[model samples]
Target: MNKSILRVAPMVLSTALCTTAFAYTVQGTVTSKADGKAIADASVSLLQKGKSAKTDQDGKFTIHEDEQDTTSTGIHNQQAVGFVNLSQGVLHYSQSSGPVQVKVFDLMGNLVSSKTLYGTGSVDLRQGINAKGTYFAKVHVGSATQNIKFTTDGNASAYSTSKTKSALLKAGDTDKLQVIADGYDTLNVTLNNLDTTLALSLEKSIPPEPTYKFGYALKNTPTPSKGCGTNTTLKTDKKVENGEHHVVNVNGTNREYFITLPTNYDNTKQYKLLIALHCYGSSAEDFVHHTPDYDHPTPYYGQQVLDKNGDYIFASLQAVGGLWNKGQEDHDFFGKALTTIEDNYCIDTSRVFITGFSYGAMFSYSLAQDYQDRVRAAATYAVADYNIWLPQEKGMDKNLPIAWMNVHGVNDDRCTFDKAKNSALPRMLKKNGKASDGDSQFTDASSEILQENQGSTGHLCYDFKNVDERFPIKFCTWPGGHQWTAHDTGNMSVGWNWESTWVPEEVHKFFEQF
Candidate 1:
């Protein structure tokens, strides 16, 4: 065939020598719903009625529509709900051309949802709808690949299922209910004033853990301890179980927490809760000399492992004077320490997880935007931008489904891993929906497979090295700078160069298959 048309003639003259002005191209092939095969990085998205895209490795993707017309924040009716609230500035994408795995079901076929893939040809998908219907997408693209289906039309799912607490309810017959979510549809609100309807759907498929590791696995049953009083200690053979040091009170203040229990904890089984934030003056027993309770001596990059064996419950919070930017109404003091650790332990509301360092990694980005329904996934180190600590664009909540990990140190100069690892973690992964386009449809041919490097602060490390071990944000750089190198429980804090086989077994293998 004429040598495969001259090797695809430079991808067809680079897709007709660059087409934009609201461009569009979504060639497909992400297979493996159960058998067929051909999925090599399956995360192809293009859900326009609003926006989305991510597919390359060959599955292919290319989206570019934003002819301005901007005005999204819709959901008018219900007397415009409360004082009427809406915000915009969205467009997310990720798939520079590597991993792509997507499996999300609802039209009855079962399977619920799954993600973790990285780029191919075109990638952009940050669709955060609140109300709409008909969604049954599946793309496995590997392991005998052969699964791909798409549909999305109910209109932002009726404005994200409308019912923000009955339009921000506030006393006067508080029962107005209508909050659906099962296979997907039914949002007709009026709660307190009476008028029901809550049959919504889509959110069921999290039972794969025979061995799909990521993070969290402990059950409570330890008995070793040696430090937690004066602070400042480094690794010492490693071993300090005891964990449990509350002071609680929250929102008003009092803070100081550290509750690790899971060697086999029992009161009738009920684990899964994680919160580890420490930076400023750092404490919680100096963030356990760097986690896994690094039997202290003066550690920062000590050493620790063993995560996915099972029982997980860890908490190490402390931030008030160790302020988290101290603005947005004091950032609900870590949601009152997650409501006092989900009202005293036995939590698992959906495997809560959080991690911070460096002003607690900008307070884990304002608690993933005001505790996105009590957190699900978040990992940060050397935070990059919170608009220099909570700039304008306030109160955003797009259905809150999160999965992000941002680490910096491209030779940080007090947070400058190229603006905290390439422009504030890809603009907060397209404002949390997971990539589409936020800073205006990005160009330079959507960042030419990135990977540049110069650092020493002058800046330049566009990086994207290797990702999609289930939505990864891995970026590395050493030659030291800011400090505290991995002592969170991987150890190496002399002059700092301790990446220690990269921490938490790759964050428990990316949330144990998230």
Candidate 2:
């Protein structure tokens, strides 16, 4: 007994010393390198230990080594699981392994809903939990499990669900420290020391490079047109008070259009021109002042409100008999109106943009192809290739690239999402130089590439990266039907009002990027 005790005594002491030696407290502060400002709510993780923490408002986080489970021997490999908030209180999971089990629980740990998805799919929380609040999800895939914390109020958290206050680290063990935040580039650092404080600076994520293949980049400098230093005249019989109303003669028929200039309009300064088109049965006057609901008096699809800086000159073009007639008549009207606008205002020739909804959206898409050389960019909502005749019959310049953005609802039976995905989106991607294989991957609804965009509360926007760098293309899909603004309309149960007005904001942002 004495010999045995003597042998075990050194071993016990050595184990104690080993644990003490590895005991470390790791703390860090994450800040933006651009401004050296604290980045709050950033996720910091010790990758190997499967430990993570969220930075406080002060951008400080602490992790303790003792919190690690010592019995777990293998390194914790990070999974590629991701989650996004879908419309009507649904949680979408993607890039997960097969037989994925998801258990959603409220803050009180009550299991709200539980289901096992085949691979990538969604769980409608409205079926189980009716209230809007913070919830936690536990996802199990094969041998790996991940936790996700999310809010039902449309704010979806990052993919990582690890909320451990501390991480485990053995002495002299090198571990990867990763930091991630919205609008910032992800950071990864190898840590070789412990019991030390760290200051990490994250760089802001750069916007995608502008192609300058079209738009302002095409011109050597801003060109002032004949319309400079002249006030616009109204030729229409209808009385207009707010904007300059004019009528253009296209093949003996009169085409009416309304133009709204910046309040501080300067003739010498060339301004970006935005041409907006109205849907079928909707007049340009109605398009300008029509109130969608009590909350939104949508003027110029809300671009006028967004342009607080008054950098854009707005134009609303009226369709012939409140319908965009097929063939070259509407096209001629568009060209003539554009020329008239350029003749009236100090327009930036290279910075002309177009946006429209429904039938107007179709026209905008047509014009984008027909006038790819003249128009800088085009953004359209609820567009289809079949309903409105395209200028392709006149021979579309497939070589000329134009930055394009399309917002379509997956449930749009009128314009149809199928046509948008199969026909419209493919055409734009092809024109933008996206490879056929890549375009096929994106346009295929059953493909994983398209499936990954399933659940978004407002909309899921996919940028075709394989396309021409100068002419980027984006396709966004929402949950509502054929409507300009995706208003919930009670049937869809899209809980937020912001969804109704998200299109204009998205359009404004997309155009501003150019």
lDDT of 2 at 148: 44
Per-residue error for 240 in candidate 1, Å, reads 28
Residue 93, model 1, lDDT: 23
Winning model by TM-score:
2
RMSD of each: 31.4, 25.3
- Each candidate: what lDDT? 0.42, 0.67
Question: What is the TM-score of candidate 1?
Answer: 0.21
Displacement of the residue 99 alpha carbon in candidate 2, Å: 99
Q: List the residue pairs that clash in candidate 2.
A: 147-161, 211-470, 227-343, 227-344
Tens-digit lDDT track of model 2 for 1-514:
0000001122232343233222346798999999999999999988766678999999999977553332242222233233333333355655443465667877655788898777456766445555667665555544333344445543332222223312222223346889999999999987744446899999999766333323333234566777777775534455464576788899998888998878988977888899988888777876566656522356777788888888889899998778886468899999999998898778987788998888888899889878976798998888888767777766754445578888877888899988888877767765666334432222312221342135544567787666644467778777777766754342256354643556677778787776
Per-residue error at 98 for model 1, in Å?
78
- Give per-residue CA lDDT, model 1, range 1-514, as digits (tens): 0000001122222332122111122233433333444334333332222233443454344433322111111222232111111122111223332344544444444555565655433222215423234333333222211122233443433222111111111111122222222222323333221111122222333343332132222221321212212221222232454465666555566656666666765534555666777777766556554443322222221212354454566777665666665665446656665666555555665557787666777777666655645566777667756533453255454323245665454555787666765565555444333223322222122232434334332222232423222233444444344543433222234433334334444555545544
